[model samples]
Target chain A: MPGFFKNKVFWSGVMALVATLILINMTSSERENITLLERILRDTYAPLQSRVTEMRDYLSGPRSIFIQKQELSERIAELEEEIARLNLSNQILRENEEEIKRLRSIINFRDNNLDKYELLAARVIARSPNNWFQSIIIDKGSIDGIEKNMPVITSKGLVGRVGSISQHTAQVNLITDREIAVGATLQRSRETSGVVEGMVEGNLLKMINIPYYASVKPNDIVITSGLSEVFPKGIDIGVIYQVTEEPNGLLLSATVVPTVNFSKLEEVMVITDFWPVSEETEAELPALAEE
Target chain B: MCYLIHFLLPFLAVFLQSTVFGFYSIKGTLPDLVLVFVICFSIVNGAGKGTVYGFLCGMLEDLYLGRFIGINAIAKALTGYITGRLQKGFFRENIIVGATAVALGTLLNAAVLLVLSRIAFPSFHIDEQFVQGVLYQFAYNIILAAPLYGWYYRSSRIGLLKLPGEK
Candidate 1:
């Protein structure tokens, strides 16, 4: 038989194996930060991603009402077409009004919770491409004071923490990823505490490692216990959906449904910093004990 | 123009997979559009080119969002090579043939990716829910395979992405 070294198929196989080895060796982990080249790539691609999102939103237009009124949508479309031909400006104005209402709500939420966080308003641009990682790309990045590991949130509740940074965009790993864990407590009865983590199941989170005797029930609200450095205290995590015993029968675990509807998430607030007391005031106790 | 189209097709699919679809993700999964694109692209081309294309595409995808590299590359390269090689005997002009290829390609891609992922990161539980998620994604790829294949077939017919030695 011909020598194996001279066989083209064998060489190709060898080459493939070598190539895979190189690629695997280059594989990275949960990096603390990205390289300059990655940043540039992210910066360049952010605008394209942003444009696609804008176009999708503009074309899809006020998704909830459109979806709900599916039966009337065809009639509405015909009517809108006629109106568009009659008065194009009127159509644009209507679209703008809808857009304005949505933006205003986001702005209003920040204003209402001005005391809670020094929030930076940002629009979600994209999400992790693969099924494995649950993350989103936000329009704001390092340039916007969005450092790595900063907590991102919405009016509904906590969203996730910033993962990687670019000049113009940052990847916010959603709370749904299996990797994330938060120190959580029962808001109604702070006596019960556990570690909240993402589940391999559906869009549900699991709070585990609670004492078997602790009182827990469905609809019980879970909030951050301030035990973790990344997230602060009292941020809403979710409501306890179902409670179950661990396989070991030692501790209890509960399924939690997140407050923020991640599917329809559009805008969010990146918490740059938060203090237990607002910056306008200082912590001090009056010398009342002297009496 | 032809080369640019060849490069841009998968990139556009990746962008779409990552961006607009993310907002409407049902049960936190979307169709593996890039995988679909690779299989379809391979069906048009042959094995040698398909394997190379698949590897490059997988590398690009891994670099973009992979938790660990080489998982997608290895999976996709195998998918591409097998699909491309198998396409020769079938009537690829038929959407059913292309769809079948995608269905099989999806299973193969899932096998490699998931097995490798589980081996590498044993922390991720491979339970009933995870299996269900894979099934959902596989079904989506099958449902979506036709339209993308049709686009590629039409584009190739029109000489849009014909490489220098493709024929």
Candidate 2:
């Protein structure tokens, strides 16, 4: 029996047979139950793994404390210098408050006449690994009134749309994802339709299907068209980098540099007030067309 | 005792490789200290124990990586078996022999990963760039293997080292 088991070919064949049986069993098992097992493992291990990571970090603490201390002292000096400048800015701000009050009276009158969209501020805690093509993780989630397909933006411009929402976290699929399609228009000439597509490298975006008749130039601002009901009209997407007339002679393509640097994103605003067009609204659209 | 060291050593090496060494890379290309550990384990322990340790370690790695759930488990088990078989033929249990074995084992591990990943994820395209990346990782792991094996041999001389002078 020992001699039979000791044969290399015999053992190899035995192992292969066992592995095949295990693989078959694993694959043929109930998928939902397997998914539940995976989720349970992930949930159980994630916190323990995070704690272990934290402990390891703590164990490797303060290797460069002396250098960091000097850096912190220099940073303090810089902050002290900035405090003086901020004091001057504070006085300027007081003077500007009076002017702002005057402007507010005018803006309040204008705002009352115009439609308004409510915005919510959310802080970003972590980003997905840099290797993942186009995804971001933000702190706010379904619990914070964030929903899938909500538009994420920054003070600078449009960032991306929310893709997944958990109770405490949300994943934003950036405008740079290949699957994400946004309706946009040229801000300068008011060209009504263009599709924004993500390029593969270097956080670049391209606006496709722009009409050749529309005069688009370099540096023309592109804004969302609000046709898809995902983003509101007039939110900035990017400035056009290059424009080329396609061989078809009907449509032009323009490469755009996104306004928000997806690499260094720290905070964003979730547009929560825009009611997405419902099935009822779709049903009423034909009636309105008849009218 | 050997099993506990096997568990702790690979975990420590991976943690340090990711954090202190900063040697993590894109895709499936990273310094494979676990492979080195398995090679050393197989050399010190016999083939049966080595194969078992390799399978368990590879399973842990698969769990951490969250992809191709059982592929590494199979590959590492095979590699462990081969290394253990080699131990019977060329049974020189010294630092130089261990280093050479690990270097060759690293190459074999990368080749196995490349072939398996290609077979498994055809659409994912692990191309020339990825192969080059693995070569770079191979060089890095080879450079670190000697000193790491030396340290293990010194600290855990019970199973790892059987010097003529030592009783």
Candidate 3:
């Protein structure tokens, strides 16, 4: 028995068994907390990581090329002149017409519906190194009312949700992050609730668990479901890129091309005031007395 | 003291790689200086220290990138351990050998990530572009390994810690 125990292979096998048990126990115990911990870690390290990346960029030298070609400069000047001329004409036309009324209506709609959101403008400071994945760092942070879980967007469409916030910087986990899952709906029919998950291959998102009977079609716009209370309702997420029925005939999935080109993100808007519903409102309402 | 340096240096490398050197792409591929640094540290040090450093570096990376929390930790730990074991059989002071090891290590690291990604996400297809990205990164990393090794070697020397066997 002593000689058998003394064999190195026996000890090695024992160690392997212990390790497997430990791993299985850990995985089972921490299954629920893993996502939350991942989020916290992302938030905490994002700023420092961003700062280090900025320093590295500084070390690597300037990124842009200064094209000093005379022809290019002349073409730029001509375009600027044309743009100025168009701006003048447009301004005169706008002044002569009821442009203010149109703007007022739009503002009124936003005020009535999106009153809770206080929008702050920011610039993109950095981007994820991998092209297949999409994420960005913005110059705004907690100091500017930016916070984790805030929704980030551009005029084009939804960009991502804020993952981390430091005093003066925030990290946005773009819609393309594999771990990101957002509740979204089809804008056209508005009949389905689907989970949007990032595809691992490319900068694309896939909506899962759409009811097979829903009237979704190609080119249907997808918007935030507002079920999670993070992103408000009606924020455009993307246009449906493809749709396929599941083999089971119960569920459908679709690929969506995000509206914001994450690679070229320059200016973004961080929503500061997505007012959450009070707990009282969420409480199951007492059954109304029969009318 | 050495453990702290090991932890901090990899963190610093990851930080720089993500923020600053991240944008410096040549033909759409950037050098993974952090991975190279970790591999070098593992080889110069030993398996135990290498595993610790690798895990910490991976944790820091996971924190910043917002990916699966333990994936990097596990990958890096394995990488460091393997590299350290390799170091045991060979001399650690050869720059060319270090560069080749780094190049191979980077390739393996990227491959591990690809396989893990596939396992974690079976719905998506891992394509040629992904493989090309890994190869391009491997080339870029090898190009920069010599300088990175030189820098770390010089710093350790200046600090009066000889190369692993210099004493």
All models, DockQ values?
A: 0.43, 0.14, 0.25
lDDT of 2 at A73: 92
TM-score of every prediction relative to native: 0.80, 0.51, 0.66
lDDT for each of the candidates? Answer: 0.80, 0.65, 0.68
- List the pairs of residues colliding in candidate 3: A53-B19, A53-B20, A54-B19, A56-B20, A57-B20
Q: For residues A1-291, could you state the per-residue lDDT of candidate 3 as single tens digits? A: 589788886686467435533443344221322345544544555667556545655655654345557868898999999999989998897685556557645544222244346889987766664443457778787777777788888888788888756566677888877667888999888889998877653556889899989888889999988776677777888889899998998999998988776555667998887775444544422221111
The regions of model 1 sitting more than 4 angstroms off are A1-28, A60-116, A274-291
Q: Which tens-of-lDDT digit does each residue in A204-234 have in candidate 1?
A: 7989988888889999999987666687777
Clashes of each: 0, 0, 5
Worst 10 residues of 3 chain A by lDDT: A282-291
Error of 1 at B157 (Å): 4.7
Q: Which stretches of candidate 2 lie over 4 Å from their true place?
A: A1-291, B11-29, B46-48, B87-92, B154-167
Candidate 2 residue pairs that clash: none
RMSD from true fold, candidate 2:
9.3
lDDT of 2 at A180: 74
What fraction of native interface contacts is shared by candidate 3?
Answer: 0.23
lDDT, candidate 2, B73-163, per-residue tens: 5566667777777877664446777778787777677666556555554534443444565566667767777887777666556553443
- Chain A only: list TM-scores of all candidates: 0.71, 0.60, 0.61
> What is residue A257's positional error in candidate 3, in angstroms?
2.5
Give residue A249's lDDT in candidate 3 (0 to 100): 89
